[model samples]
Target: MLFGAESNLDLALALYDLGGVQFGDFDLGPTAGRSPIYLNPRVLISDPAVLRRIALLIHHEIQADQARRRPRLASFAAVAGVPMGGLHLATAYALVSDTPLLYVRPDSQQPSIEGRIIPGQTVLVIDDLMTGGTSLLRTAKALEESGLVVRDFIVLIDREQGGTERLHEHGYHVMPILRLRTMLTYYHECGLLDTARYRTVMDYLERTSPRRWSGSP
Candidate 1:
């Protein structure tokens, strides 16, 4: 169990219940050709109880990492969320943890980070999902440009499509609450997902995984 069995299963079931996990052919833009399962954490926003559960899980993960003396658990002054989907999760986490929240506006004429702009502050980046790692990188760049340090990222779900690897290559630590494979397996075992869909997602993940997979949790 990479991220704990009970909690991961709970979140997976919650996502399924909230209709966040859809099984079908989905166009994931140019970077991700096609995906059998589409994870939309944004749906959690409509369910505050589940969203708070997620925030608690993320907070617990950070506390656990700090307890283990993980090097990437360096003290961060604030939590920055990637725009659109990530912002909502970040906001929930911030509210529950009593931490300041920040966000980046990459599409602006002059891209900038919102919230208290404090130079030399370390920030924990948050996002709803990780696919190609493009959004996280862009947000990190924006924060760095604004004199903030970003060394660790917290994503609700990792699609396992090289996003974590790509972020690792750039010297960033990613902590995902749940992996797509784990969620799919949990769903299938719980009778929420049919065998055909489970196999489809597993094959998709295997085919799109990095060539030199290190199998990091």
Candidate 2:
């Protein structure tokens, strides 16, 4: 019922309406290439109420994970966010859950673990989306190098473009609030996405996802 959606389907639609999901041709980046759909959870910031709802949902997930005796996120000391997207999400989570926060700077003079982050402290890395797993891996490595332990990665959306599998293969765990397949299917079912665009996006996912998990080049 959070974000004024009665069900996950409704929530997905709400996200679509909120500009979190966009259709039509797009070039995510040189490396990301062309795609028919773009998911930007950052849009949620324009509507504080909606963003708060998402932050709350993420907080609940963290709490639930902690409740599990053997949960991977049960022992984190702070929330470390990947730059751009993860920063806001981490700020929200820290506010909602009163959890400590860790930031990894993009500049040369990165903060030391002794002051900013305690050495040997467990951390859960948060990000807005995972496309190729590069940012997540970089953030994890940065944290580890600074003496923080990173065992979990959480994101608002998983593009389902093999990023999750890649992280898993590297022995890092990932959690996503919504998946690309689920989002695209919901849009199609709701008539928000035309048949052509729907097929285009799904086809892209199919073509690209295999290479990631299959260990093929």
Candidate 3:
């Protein structure tokens, strides 16, 4: 029911600006050649209060999801993050919920010998963005190989590029705090964003969206 509420969207947009998360003008090619509206949530670490606020946002979203998803992740065994990018956000969320923290490292080794490096509990994967969900999927695999279940993925943004859909299609539920469409629309409505700049991103995302909707890499 909270999916498209105006206040949640307003708060999300406010966080996007107040957190000072930079959005890139150039595409970063998770699409191989397309990229637009890059967001860096790492900036929140510089401000402890903002970091906590971000945590609160995540906590609220998780609470809502727990009450909603069947099999109920309310007592989720642990919180796990995809390496390098998702570590801090995962830590922040874990700190807020008083939940245990786990991490999925890049398995740069031969297949069978890659144990103890990935996650090992029913983990909730956190990341700032879900571009193609490459890292998320790999992390989930690593978790499973280590006898874990990754039932849910949470992200700060879901670029409207089917990242969210793909994750759900792959049998993992996705909870995104915000999507690019409403985000861009909110900023444009508030005059926080230039029309031309916003248009460029909207057009780019449209053109670069994957033709096949499968959640594969």
Query: How do all models score by TM-score?
Result: 0.93, 0.87, 0.78
TM-score of 3: 0.78
RMSD of each: 2.9, 3.1, 4.8
Model 3 lDDT, residue 206, Cα = 68
Compose the digit string of candidate 3's lDDT tens values, residues 60-99.
7677766775734435678777776677888898888987
Per residue, candidate 2 scores C-alpha lDDT tens digits across 99-171 of 8988777665764332366888889999988998999898889889887898898888888887877898999
lDDT of each: 0.87, 0.80, 0.70
Candidate 1 minimal-lDDT segment of 10 residues: 208-217
Clash pairs (backbone) in predicted model 3 = 27-35
Which pairs clash inside model 2?
none
* Position 28, candidate 2: lDDT: 88
Candidate 1 lDDT over 1-217, as tens digits, reads 2345697678888888989989789999986788887888888888888888888888888888788844556779899999989998999999989999999875797777789988999999999999989999999999999999999999999988899889999999898888888888888888888998789889888877885366544
Lowest summed lDDT over 10 consecutive residues: which window, candidate 3?
Answer: 110-119
The TM-score-based order of candidates, best leading, equals: 1, 2, 3
What lDDT score is found at residue 96 in candidate 1? 86
